[model samples]
Target chain A: MKRLKPSLVFIFLVMPCSLLVAFTYYPAIKSLFSSFWNQGTSRRPSKFVGLENYQTLLADDVLAQILWNNALYALVTIPISIGLSIGMALLVNSKIKGTSLMRLSFFLPTMLPMIAVANIWLFFYAPGIGLISQIMQYFGFEPINFLGDASTSLWSMIVVAIWKESGLFMIFYLAALQAVPANLKEAAKIEGASGIQVFFDVVLPLLKPTTIFVAVNALINSFRLIDHVIVMTEGGPNNSSALLLYYIYEVTFAYRDFAYGSALTVFLVALLGLMALFQFKILDKKAHYQ
Target chain B: MKSTINRIAYSTLAISLATVWGFPFIYSLWAAFHEEKYSANFTWNAPLTLENFATVWAAAPFSLYFTNTVILTLIILASNLILCTLVAYAFARYKFPGAGLLFSFIMVQLLITPDILIVENYNTLAKIGLIDTIFGITLPYLTSAFGIFLLRQTFKTVPISLDEAAQVEGANTWRVLWDVYVPLAKPTYLAYALVSISFQWNNFLWPLIVTNSPEVRPITVGLSIFATVESGVEWALVNAATLLSTAPLVILFLIFQRRFVANFMRAGIK
Candidate 1:
C-alpha cells in the first residue's frame, strides 16, 4: 500500500509533465508574452510595446487576405468533405461485396503524405506540359495557368485539400455508420418508411454525435493541413492563396521575424482554444476517463 | 424493380467516385514507369523502364534522408510509447492531486499542437543549441497528447481485477504496469505506433523549418526539394521519388489495413 501510494505518482508523472510543459505550454506562454515585444538586436534585449503587435495584425493587409483564404478554405472544404465522407462511408458500409477495394481507393489519399499529394497535384496544375493543359489541348482550348493566376490559385489548392482529407474523414463516418445496426433500418422499412425518409428519420439522429466529432476534426485539419500551400504556390500570385498557419511559417522562417509571428500564433492559439472550449461545453459530461 | 435500379445507381456512383479518387495514384504509376514523352498521355503501348528510379536516386541523397527519417521516427516512437504509457497509467489508476488540471493541460495539446508553435519552438531549440540536429526535429513531439489520451482510454477499460491479481501476487507498480496493463493494451500500442510512425515519417513542415542541411532531412522534405521547379520538372523522376517516399506506408497499409482500421476503432480514435 505504501509503495502504491501517491508518493510514487511523481515518478510516473514527472517526465511526461516536463515534456508537455517544455514543448507545448512553455512555448505557448512564451509566445503570448513575446508577442508584445519587439525582436531583440545584438546589444539590446526585446522591449515591451504593448498592443503594437495586435495593431500590426489589424493593419496587415496580406494577413487579412490570408485569414480570409483560411476561412474560405474552411468553408469550402469542410462541408464538401463531410458530405463526401458520409457518402463514401455509406457506400462502403452497405451490405455489398467489393467494398474493400472501393474502401482502398477512398482511403489511399489519406495514406500518402500531404507533401507527396501536393507534389502529385502540382503536376496536374502545372501549365503547358501538365496533364490538365494536355487535356484542354486535346479539346482545342487554351491552357490557363492554374497556380500562377491569382483568382484560380486558392481554389485549385482547395480542391487538392478536398481530395486529401475527405478520404480520411470517410473512415470515421464508416465506423459510425457501421454501428447503426441493420434492424433499425429494417424496422423503419416495415413501418412503410422510404429509404430517404428512413435515412433522415432514423440515421441522421444516430449520426449526430459522429457528425459533431468529425466536424471538430475537420475544423482543426483545415488549419493544420496547409502543407499544400507550401508546395503548390508558396501562397503566391501575391498572397492570394495564403493561410494563417502557413503565413506564420512565412513570417517566422522566411522573413525571420519571431515577434510578429508570435502575435499571429496567439491568434491561431486563441482560435483553436475557443474551439476546444466549445467542444468542452458540449462534451462536459460525456468526456471519458477522468 | 425500383430497388434494383437504386442498387445499380449507387454502385455506379460509388465506383466512379472511387476511380476519381484513384486517378492520381494510377497516373503516378503510369507516369513513373513510362517514358517521359508519353507519361502525360495514357496509352496502352508506352514502353516502361526503371530509369526514373535511377535518375531520382542519383539526383538526391535520399539514402541519407531515409536514414534520418528512420532514426528520428524510432526515437519519437520509443520515447512516446514509454512516456505515454507511464502517464496514461497514472491518469487512469492513480489519485494524485492536480491530476485534473494536468490532464486538461495535456489535452489542450490536441488544439495547440507542437506544429502550431513552430516559431517559438525554433527559438526553444536555438536556446538549447539543438537547432538543425535530428533531435531538434523531434524535440517538440517526444510526448504526444493523442497517445496519452488514447492509452488512458485503453487502460481504463482494463479490468481492475487483473491489476489487483497482479498486485496481490506482490507485483510493484512498475511491474504491474509492465506485467498487467502494458500487455493488455497491445492493440492500442499498435494503433498509436502506426499513427505516430507514419505521421512523423511523412511530417514535412517542422522538419523543414528546423533542419537546414540535407543531413537531417526526412524523405518528405527531401521529396519537396527534389521536385522543385528550378530543376526543370521531369514527371518520371518526380513521380518515382514520390512513389519511393510513399511506398513503405502504402505497402504496410495494404498488408495490415485490417489491423490498422481495427485498432483505430478499438482504441476509439478516428
Candidate 2:
C-alpha cells in the first residue's frame, strides 16, 4: 500500500499528460517527418524526397503569396488591435460615469464565437443591401465590394478580428493599469507634467510589461486568424486573402494533398515557435522595468 | 483651456470608438428580432418580432447542437481541471527528473495551436476511428498547457507550512493537496475554469473538422450552416441563427458580468 501510493501519483500525473503528448506532440513530430515526403493520394508508403518539398514550397507562387498575405495581415492587425485595446483600457479605467457598462459593452463581442460573429459581419458585408454599402450609398458613393474584392477582403477580416480581440486585450491593460502607482501620476502632475506628458513619461513606461504581453498575444492571434477566413473568404477571390493556415487547410482537406499540407504545417509550427521564443526573450528582457 | 479641449477630445474619441465597437452588435440584435427582407438598409422604423427566432429554432436542430456543445465543453473542462491540477501540483512541489523538460514540452503545445495542427490532427483522428465522435472533438483540448502553467504558478504561491501541517496530522499528499492546496487556489481554479469554458464554448475549427453530421455538431458549426450557399444569404435568418448560437455565452456574460471581467483580468493574457 505504501509503495502503491507514489506509483498511483506517478500514474495519475504521467498518464493524462502522455495522452496529451500523444495527441499533440506525436502528430507534431509526424508532421515534421511527413513534410519531407510525397504522400498525396495513394495508399503507398511515403517515400521522402529529401528537402525537395522545401524547395518546392520556396518556388510555389501560391505559397509565397499566402506568406506575404499572412505577414501583411499580422503587421496591420497586431498594431491596430493593441492600440485600440490600450485606448479602451484607458477609457474604461477613467473615473467616468457608467464605466462598468462601457467595459461590458466593449468586452461583449469577445464572448461571442468567431463563427457566429463572422456570420453577422458576412451579412454586413453583403453586396448592395449590406449595412456598410448602404451607408456608403447614403454618403454619395458607389457601393464597394468589401469581401469580393481581394484588396478589401483581408482588411475586412482584420476589422472583425480587431473588433473581437481588442476588448479582451483592454481587460488585461485595465488590470495592469490598476496596478500602476497612483502617487506617481500625482507626482508627475505636481511637477508641471501635462496629462499627455504624464502618460508618455510615467504611464506608458509603467505599462510596458503589459504592452509586451499584449504584443506577444496579438502576434499569436494574428497567426491563428484562420477561423474567420475559413468561414468568410475560404482564401477566395483568387487566393488574395489566403493566410498561411487557411492555405494549409485547403492543401490538406480540400485538395487532399497531405504531404504538402504537412510541409506547410511544419513551416507554421516553426514560425510560431520562433515567435514564442522572440516574445519570451525580447519582451521578457524589456518587461522587467521595476 | 487646452486641458479642457483635451478632455473633450478624449471623451469624444472614447464615445465614438465605443459606438464603432458596439454598433455591429446592436445591428445584429436588431436584425435578429426584425423580419425585414433586406438587412442592408438601416432604418429605425421597423417593428421587432420574435418570428425569426422561432424560424431559426425550427429550421435546424440547434437543441442538439447546444447539447453536444455543453457536453463536450463540460467534458473538456472537467478533464482539464483534474489533470491540470494534478500535473501542476507535481511540477510545483516535486523534484522529479525531467520535470522541467515535461513542463516545457507542455508549453510547446501553446505554440502549436489546433489551427496549425488541423490537417495532421484530422488524419490522426481518422486513424483512431474517433472522427465524428464527441470524444474526438473534445479529446485534443482535454489537457491544456495554459491551465497547467497557470495553476502551477498559483500552487507555488501556497506556503509549505500548510503541507507540512497536513503531513503532521497524518494526511496523505493527495489529502494535503485537496484540503490545503485546492482551497487556497480557489480563485485560480475559478479563473482557469472560466477561461477553459470560454475557449471550448467558442471553439470552431476542431468541431468543424471532426463532426460530419448535425447530430454531433456544436452551436458554432450548426450556425455556420446558415451562411452556406444553400441558405441563400438570408441576412435576417443568419443574424437570428447567430444570436441563438451565441445566446448562452452572451447570457452568461450578462449574468456574471462583473465576475467575467474580473476573471478575464486575473487571467492576465492581453
Candidate 3:
C-alpha cells in the first residue's frame, strides 16, 4: 500500500512534469552545461573549456552591441508601450463615439503574425518608393532609408515593437479600467477632484497589479521577440539592429557556435531570473497595498 | 464654447490615431484587390481582381503549410489540455513534499521559454531524429507553463465539497478529477485553448529554425521566406498571401472579441 501511494503520487505529478522535461527542464540544464564547453558539431563531443566561452562573449564586440541594443529596446519600448497602452485603454473606456472601432483597430496588430507584419513594414520603410518616403516627399523632406541606415535601423525595429506591444497591453489595462467601481469615481468627483486628480488618486492605484503584469510581459517580449528582426533587417546595417536573442540565433544557427550561443542564452536566463525577482517584489508590494 | 472646441480636437486626434493603426492592413487589403500596376499607388479607377490570391496560392504550397499548421496546433492543444489539467489538479488538490519548489521551477519556464533553449533543443531533437518534422517544431511548445498556471487557478476554484462528495461515492482520485474538476473548468479550458490557438498559429522563430521542408513548415515561416526570397517586387502577391494567413484570426476576433475579453478576464491573467 505504501508503494502504491508513491506510485500514485508519481502518476499524478511526475508523469506530467516528465513531458516538459524533454524540452524545458532538460534543455535548460543542457544549455547550462554546454555553455561551459566548446562543441562544434553533433558528431563530436563538447570539450569542457572552463569559462573560455564566457571570456569570448565578454570581448565580443557584436555581443556587446547586441546587449546594448536589447537594453535600449527594453528601456525605450517598456515605458512608451505602457503609457500608450494606458492612454488607449482610457480612450476606449470613455463613452466616446466609435469606441469599439477604435479598440478593434488598435488591437488588430496583436492578431497579425509578426513575420507577415514585418513584410508589410518592409514596404513602409524602404527607400524612395516606400510609404514613409512618399509622405516625406510631399513635405519636401529628404527620403530616409529607415531600414538601411545604421542609425535608424534599430529605431525602426523599436517602432514595430512599440506598435505591436501597445495594443495588446491596452487590453489588460482596459479590463482593469472596466473593473474599477463607478461609485468610487463618482465619490472622488463629489470630493471635487479633477479628472486628472481622480485618475492619479484613485484609478491609478487600482490598476497597479495589472500594470505590474503588463510591464513584466513587455519586458520579456522585448528580449525574446526577435521575429521581426529576422524578417525585416536580419540584424543588418553592421549589426546595429541586432538584439541579443537574434544574435543568439545567428551565432548558434548560422555560425554553428553552440558554446558561445549557450553563453548568450545564459545571459538571457539571468536577465529573466532578475525579472522574476523584480516581479516578486512588485507582487509583494501589491499584497502590501491590499 | 471652449469646451466644445476641445472636444472636437480630442475626437479628431483619437480618430487619426486609430487610422494610423489600421492603415497597414488597409493598404494590404487595397493592394490585394487591385491589379499589380494600379496597386503601386492609390488609383480609384483601378480594376479589382481576385487574381493576386490565385497567384500567391500557386507561388507557394500554402495549402500544405496550412495543413501542417493545423495538425501541429491540434497536437499541441490536445496534449496541453490533457497534461496541464492533470498537473494543475495535482497542484490544487495535493500537498506533496517539494511541490512548492517544483511549482516555482515550472514557473521559471513562464519567463524563460523554450525559445531561449533553442540551441540545446535543436541538438537534442537532432539526436532523437525528429529534425525537419512537424513533431520537431511542435515538441518544445507542447507543455505550456501558461496552460498549467491558468488551469491550476481554475481548478482551485472548484468547490472542495464536490470533490469530497465524489470521493464518498467511491470515485477514485482520477475519477474525482475527471468527474468534478475537469467538468467544472470547461470554460477555462475554452478560454485557454483559444489563447493557445491564436498564439501557436502565428508562432515563428523556433518553427523557422526547426522545419525546412515545405511539408513541415508552418505558414508564418513559409510566408517569411517567400517575402525575402521573392523580394519587394511582388507586393500584391505578398499582401494577398499575408491576408490569407491573417484573415481567419481577424474574423475570429471580430466575431468573438467579447468572449475573448471576458475569457481573458476570467483567466485572471495578472
The numbered model that scores best in DockQ is 1
TM-score of 2: 0.95
Rank by lDDT, descending? 1, 3, 2
lDDT of 1 by residue, A22-68 (tens): 98999999999999998777898889999999999999999989989
Which is superior by TM-score, 1 or 3?
A: 1
Model 3 ranges off by over 4 Å: A1-4, A41-46, A287-290, B1-6
Interface RMSD of each: 2.2, 3.6, 3.4
Per-residue accuracy of model 3 over B51-163 as CA lDDT, tens digit each: 99898888889898888888999999998998888788888888777877999888778887887788989998899999999988888887888888888898888888898
lDDT of 2 by residue, A162-243 (tens): 8899988888888888888999999999999988899889998878878787787788877775788888988878888888
TM-score of each: 0.96, 0.95, 0.95
Candidate 1's error at B123, in angstroms?
0.5
Top candidate on TM-score is 1
Q: Where is model 2 more than 4 Å wrong at Cα?
A: A1-9, A40-45, A287-290, B1-5, B267-270
- What is the C-alpha lDDT profile of model 3 across A54-153, one tens digit per residue? 8998799988888899889889999998998898998888866999999998998898889878877887787987778989998999999999999999
Give residue A144's error in model 3 in angstroms: 0.5
Top candidate when judged by lDDT against the true structure: 1
The DockQ of predicted model 3 stands at: 0.57
